[model samples]
Target chain A: MMTFLVRRLAIILPTLVFVSFIIFGLQQLLPGDPALAMAGEERDPDAIAHIRKTLRLDEPIAMRYAYWMAGVVQGDLGISLRIQKPVGELVLQKLPVTLQLAAMAMLVALLIGIPMGMLSAVKNGSAWDYGANVIALWGLSTPNFWLGIMMILLFSVELGWLPASGYVPPAEGLGANLAAMVMPAFVLGNAIAAVMMRHTRSAMLQVLSSDYVRTARAKGLYERAVIGKHAWRNASIPVITLGALEFGQLLSGAVLTEQVFSIPGFGKLIVDAVFNRDYAVVQGVVLCTASAYILLNFLADIAYMLVNPRLRS
Target chain B: MTALLEVEDLRTSFKVESGRFQAVDGIDLRLEAGRTLGVVGESGCGKSVTALSIMGLVASPPGEVAAAKIRFEGRDLLALSADAMRDLRGDRLAMIFQEPMTSLNPAFTVGDQIAEAIQRHRGLDRAAAWARAVEMLRRVHIPAAEARAHDYPHKLSGGMRQRVMIAMALALDPKLLIADEPTTALDVTVQAQILDLLRRLRAESGMAILIITHDLGVIAELADDVTVMYAGKVVERAPVEALFEAPQHPYTIGLLGSIPRLEREQARLDAIEGVVPNPLSPPAGCRFHPRCPFAEARCREAEPGLGPVGPSHFAACWRTPLP
Candidate 1:
């Protein structure tokens, strides 16, 4: 297991390097110049030249890349010219907020999706099966942003139950933070729940028909024990993979859902950075999301070993 | 003595997209305690379905099983509630199936699976069940049962896995064990070993065994009584020696002929010609007429019911007293 972990880490390190390279390289290709963006309306040539030299825009691309990477490696993500703040500090501010939202969304997804999937599979060919599938279709098809808007209108405008838009830090109060974050989290969650439902349903259907399931039945197990204990254990393997990948996507898929809710998270930060041509903040956020995806995949492999003894070898 | 199990007019049908078809057509089976009854047939002849139907493990809706009476220890199984049936199963009745490699749950250790059954029916605590599982494993001749109990299903070979399956099924000391082609997936040597293990276990437990297989050789070795089926109907049934010595049904003769023997020299191996009739649309008259070489005019006009051909033998053939 240690050897496997070492091997996976070896693969992850280079992937992160490649991802950082892409982020930095893409940021370099953006049309707006940092020096020009920093300059005011009464732009002087010498002032611009001095700013360019200072920012190393006049240096070789390789030299500039090396400089950028050195700072990134030392936990410096340069500075967002628009906000005149360190990009690393901006990312840190938004990370926890987004992480909390993503976690809540995933929690809602898992709570609803897995059981529904198992129920659907066990009650296959019944009305309940079709009903769950129909609901899943709606969840999958409806854009989360539109769903977020509708939820806001119902829960906030009509019912006056939740805050319409904006976020509260957990430090203020976890309940209040949850109240503020709930709608957007659900809007994000329901769509992912649909995907989880489909994956879990199919996985369960396959497992339910397996030879071991037949053996389980022959053992005189109650239908519930057969489905829950024996079948679900095998069925959940694929769902685990889906959950990790979905969580990784949730970190980035939060973009539109985040936008609609006015939650100050990575989505809003990145959007503002892009519009303001704040390349450093965009690079930092994208780099972080990519690393998360790689890390999630790595964690998923470990989870597979833990859950399926067949893979432990 | 009263029979351990009495299955009468046990019919099973499967509703498929094409149409409904009878898989086990009005079959009857009787087994006495401390005896083995072998149900032998080619694939698609409903032998496995018969076993499943008896065990109440057949999937519903697509599959349906009905019988006039399926009495186990004088209790009519068909009259029992679903829960009552479940309580009986894996307790008074246990089953092992073909493809032992796939039959054991891969997600759990072999020990956990066996222990689970013990705990479910025996009311044993976790540690006691675990100890019983290990003991069961050892009884099945699995070497190093203590260590092997910790190994997952995949860690064992096909034969070892079948042994594990037998261990699990017999953990509760079920009165009747229905083994559906249990050794079908093992190699020849392993097959013999499993058969030997089963015979030994039967001698030890004095449990009635309902061994389903397509191999007459297997029936010869392990069975006291044998029922031969063809195209979803029992064609012949008799004590093992009588069936082999005076096989009355043509299909039974065909089945016995198909077995390659070192003693019986032939230029070419004799194989029963023609495939099994499509289950969806079996023939109007005798189901085996299309495949039976000695099929006569009366054979195609009407299906023959089981008739006494000898002192203790019955056959379902119009020309059973073959010339």
Candidate 2:
């Protein structure tokens, strides 16, 4: 296990470097010049030149990449051209909000999805199974942003039960934070839940039909015990893999959801940076999201070993 | 003495897309205390279904099991409530399946699986159940019973896994053990070893055994009484020696003849012609008429029921004496 972890970490370093290079190249290729965006409609060429020189935008692409890579190694993520502040500091400020939102969304997805999926599998052709399938289909088809808007209109505008848009940190009264987060989380979580439910149902259906489950039943175990004790653990392996992939997606793909809810998360920060031609902030956020994706996959491998002892060797 | 298990006119059918298919049709079985009853048949001839029906393990909707009477220890098993049947299973009645690789739960340790049965039926605590699991493993002749108990099914060989399954089934000391092709998936040596273990266990516990298999050699080796089935119906039943020495039904004679004999220098082994008919649409009269060499026009026109041929022997055929 120790050797496995060491090898995984070694692979992660090169992947992160490759990801950083891609993020830097993509940011550099964006249409708008960062120097001009910072200058903000200034007519003077001399002023634009001075801004470009200060930001080191005048250097060759390779030189600029080397400088950026060097700064990344030294824990300096460069300065945001629009805000004139360290990109690292900006990301640090917004990272918690995104993390909290993604975590809450995942929690909601799992709590509802797994049970619904199991029920669908157990009661295969029953009304509950049909109903869950329909709901899953709807959730999968509906865009998160559109769902967020609909939820806001229904729960916030019509019912006046939750705040329409915004965020509140958990430190400032748990109720208010949860109230502010509910709609956005639901919107983001619904699609993930649908995917989870479908994957879990298929996995469970396959496991339930296996000969071991028949043996369990032959042992005189109740249907509940057979499903829960014998079948659930084996079925959960695929679901865990799905969950890790969904979580990585949530962290990066929450841009439209964060936009819809007016949450000041990393997704929103990256979006604003794109419009403002803040290359450093864009590169920083991309690097962070990419690292998170890699880390989540690594954690999933560990979880697989824990769930299936056969895989330990 | 009262029989440990007595099943009469037991019929099991499945409702598939094509139509209703009878898997086990009008079968009768009896097992006396401490004795072995071998049910021999070709594949798809209801050998396993009869065992499952007795255990009430057949799934409904797709499959249904009905019988005139299924008495176990003087109680009507078919009339027991689902919960009552559950209590009987793994406690009063246990079963071991054919495929050991697929039968034992891969996620759990061999000890834990056996211990679960002990805990469920015997009401033993975890530690005591664990110890009993080791004891059961030892009884099955598995080496390093203590350490092997902690190993999962995947870590064990096919023979060892089957032994673990036997340990689990016997952990609660059920009065009746239904072994459905228990040694079919095992190697020849392992099959002999498993049969020996079962024989020893039965002698020790005085528990009745219902051994289902296609191998006549197995039946001859382990069974006191033998039942021969052809296409979901029992065609002949007699003592082991009578069935082998004076087989009645053509199906039974064919089955015996098919076994390769070392004494005979035959160019080829005798094989029963044709396959077991599809249960979905079996022959209108006799299920095995198409495959039977002695099948006549009357045999093809009407099904035959069991009739006395000799002492404690029965045969189902149009012509018992064969002219």
True contacts kept of each: 0.78, 0.62
Q: Which stretches of candidate 2 lie above 4 Å from their native place?
A: none
DockQ of each: 0.83, 0.75
Task: Sort candidate 2 into its docking category.
Answer: medium
Give lDDT per model, in order. Answer: 0.90, 0.89
> Using DockQ as the measure, which candidate wins?
1
Please estimate how well model 2 matches the true structure, expressed as its whole-model Cα lDDT: 0.89
TM-score of each: 0.98, 0.97
Per-chain TM-score, chain A, candidate 2: 0.96
Writing each residue's lDDT as its tens digit, candidate 2 over B133-214 gives 9999999999999999999889999999999999989988889999999999999999999999998999888888999999
**Candidate 1: where is the Cα deviation over 4 Å?**
none
